[model samples]
Target: MPRRSYDHYCAASRALDVIGDRWSLLVVRELLSGPRRYSDLFADLPGISTDVLATRLKDLERDGILTRHRIGPRATSAYELTVDGAALRPVLDALSAWGTPALGERRPTDAVRAHWLALPLGRAIGEQIDKGTVTVRIGETVFHVVVDGAEITHQDGPAPGPAIDLVLDLATANAVANGTLALADAGPDAQWSS
Candidate 1:
C-alpha cells in the first residue's frame, strides 16, 4: 500500500495522513494502556485480520505514532505509543464522549472487554481524585488504573497494596461514561473501598 491521503492542505487532512486507515485509531486505543505484544493486540482487537493488524502497526511506526521493541533474552516484541501517540489521549477522549450516546444497550452479538472502559472511566476517576490507584472489576476481568496528577494509566489485573477498589457492570460503566450517572452514586451493587 502506498498510503492514502486526503490530498488537501488542511490540518485535519494532515492528521488523516497519519491515522486515516481503518484500524489505525483502534490500534492506538489498545496501545494507550502501555506496551502490548502483537498477539495481545490481535486478541483484544476482535475482528481485525492478521494482515491488517500488521500493516497498521507498520504504518503507526512509520508515522512515529508508536514503536516496536524487543525485550529480554526471548526477544519478546511489544508495541507502545510514542509521546506524540500518547498525546492522542484527548482526541480519543473526545471521540469516546462523542460516541457514547450511540452505545445504547449491548446486543446479543456484542463482544465486551473490561479494559475498553479504561479511557473514559479513567477520566471519570481522575476527576474524582487528584492521585490514587483504582482497581476496577467488571465481572471476572480486573484492571488497575493509576492517576498521577493529570495523567491516568491502566493495566491488566489489580493494583498492588492499598488502593481504592471499584466494582461495577457494563451498564453502569456506560452511564458513567455518558455522564448520566455519577460514580459516587453507583447504587448498592457497586462497591468501592478506599
Candidate 2:
C-alpha cells in the first residue's frame, strides 16, 4: 500500500507526510534513548500489534528517520535513530510540554512506564544543572538521566558511576513532570545520594 500524504506543499504538511502515521512518532520516541532490539520495542510499547510495529519500522527506515544495524556480541538487529531522526528531539519536547497539562490524573486503564517519564523529568532537571548524571528512583523503577549542557539522554537502570541519586514517589515525580514543582523544590523528603 502507498503511504498517505496531505498533498499540500507546506513544510509542516510535508514533514507530517513522512511521520503522521499512527505509531510512527512513537517509534521515534522509543529510539530517542538509543538503539533497541525488535523485542525491546515490542515489549515497551504496550498495545502495539506486531504487524503494525514491523510496518512502522519499515516506514521510518524508508523515510531516513531510523536505521537497522547489527549490534552486541550476538549481532542482534537493532533500530536506532539517524541524525535526521535525532533532530526530532525538539519536536518531541514540544509535544511533551504541550501534552503535560492533559495528563491531569492517571486513569486506572492507562498503562504506565517509568522510562516514559524520562524526557519530561530530564528536561526539568536540565533547567537547574548544566551537566551531570542523575539517577532517579520512582518506587521500584530505576532510570538514570545524563544532562550535558542543553542535551539530555536517559536509560533504564541506575548510573554506572557516581551520580546525584534522587528517590521520589510517583506523585512527586508527576509534579516535577507537570512543572508545578521544580526538582530543587522537591522538599526534604526527596532523598539524595551523591
Candidate 3:
C-alpha cells in the first residue's frame, strides 16, 4: 500500500508524511541504539504485527531514515539509522521528557521491557556525568549507559570494561527518568565498581 500524506505544503506536514505512522517513530527508537535484525526489532516491539513492522521498515528505508544491510558469517539482514534519522535523537529525548510524568505507575496491562527504559534513563544519567560508562542492573536485565561529551548512548547488555555499577529496581529507575529522583540521590546503596 502507498503512504498516506497530509499533502500540505508545511514542513511539519511533509515530515509527518514520512514518519507520521504509528510504529514509525518507535522503529526509529529501537534503531537508535544500533543496527538490529528484523527479528530483534519484532521481539522488542511487543504489539506490532509482522506485516505492519515490515511496512514501516520499508517506508523508513525508502525515505532514507534507515538502511538495511547484511552482515555476519550467515549474512543476516539488519537495519540501522542514517545520519538524518539519528538526528531524531533530540526529538525522541524531548518526547521522553514530556511523557515521563504520565508514566506514574506500571499498570497490569502495561508491557514493560527493561531495555525500553534505556533511552530515558541514559538521558538522566547523562545530565550528571561529564563522560563515563554506567552499568545499570534492574533485576535480571542488564545494560550500560555511555556518556561521551554531550552525547549519550546505551547498549542492551553489560559494559565491556570497568565502570560505575548502578544497582536499582524499576521503581527507582522510573523515578529518575521522570525527574522525580536524581541520579546523585540514588545514594550509597549503589555500588561503584572498577
Candidate 4:
C-alpha cells in the first residue's frame, strides 16, 4: 500500500487513518462485546454487507487491530481484540454518551443510565424482598428502586426507605433496564442468569 499525506490538525483525519470507515469502528464495537464469531458479528451488526464485512475484517487483521481464530467449519470463527483494538473501550463509551443526548432532554442517556441505574439490581435478590424498599447494587454502587406511575426506576447515594418499586442487578440489571433484555429475560431462571 502507498502512504498519503495530510495536515496534522485534522485529528479526525488521523483517527480515520487508523479507523476511518464506518465498518471498522462498528467492528470494534462488536469485538468490545467480547470474542465473537463471523456470524455473531453479522447477527449483531445487521447493517453490514457480507463482502464489506469480509474486507473490513481482512484489513483489520492486516493492520493488527484484531486477530482471527478458527473453529472447524460450522461458523467460520471468531475475532478477538489485540491490545490496540481493545484500547478503544473508553472511546466507545464516550462516543455512546455523546450521541445519547441527541435523543433530547426528556430522554435519558440510554447507555449510562442503564448502567448506573442497574448498578443495584442483580440475580441474588431473594425469592421475595422482605422489605418494601427496592434494592440495587452494582459493584460498590447502590440505589433504591423507585416507581413513577407505571414506569419503574431508582434513586440513590444511600439505602432506600420503604415504598419503592423497582430494584436491579448492575450488569444484568442494565441489560434489562436498557432494553437489551426483558423482565422475563432477567428472571433468575433465564439462561443468562445461570
* Deviation (Å) of 133 in candidate 2: 2.4
CA-lDDT, candidates in order: 0.88, 0.89, 0.86, 0.56
Poorly placed runs, candidate 1 (over 4 Å): 148-151, 178-180
- Model 2 residue-pair collision total: 0
lDDT of 1 by residue, 1-194 (tens): 79788999999999999988899999999988778999999999999999999999999999999999998799999999999999898788789878877877777887778788887888889988999999998888788889999888888788999999999987887677667888788797578887
Ranking by lDDT: 2, 1, 3, 4
| Backbone collisions counted per model | 0, 0, 0, 9
Measured by C-alpha RMSD in angstroms, how accurate is candidate 3? Answer: 2.1
Please give each candidate's TM-score: 0.88, 0.88, 0.88, 0.51
Off by over 4 Å in 2: 72-75, 187-189
Residue 180's lDDT in candidate 2: 81
lDDT at position 170, candidate 2: 81
lDDT of 4 by residue, 1-194 (tens): 53343546787777676777668887886676357788877765666799889988887887788999887767468798899887775566556545433533233433333333331232222223433444454555545543333233334443434443334455566555344555556666333210
Pairs of colliding residues, candidate 1: none
C-alpha positional error of residue 84 in candidate 3 after TM-score superposition, expressed in Å: 1.4
Error of model 1, residue 96, in angstroms? 0.7
Maximum-lDDT candidate: 2
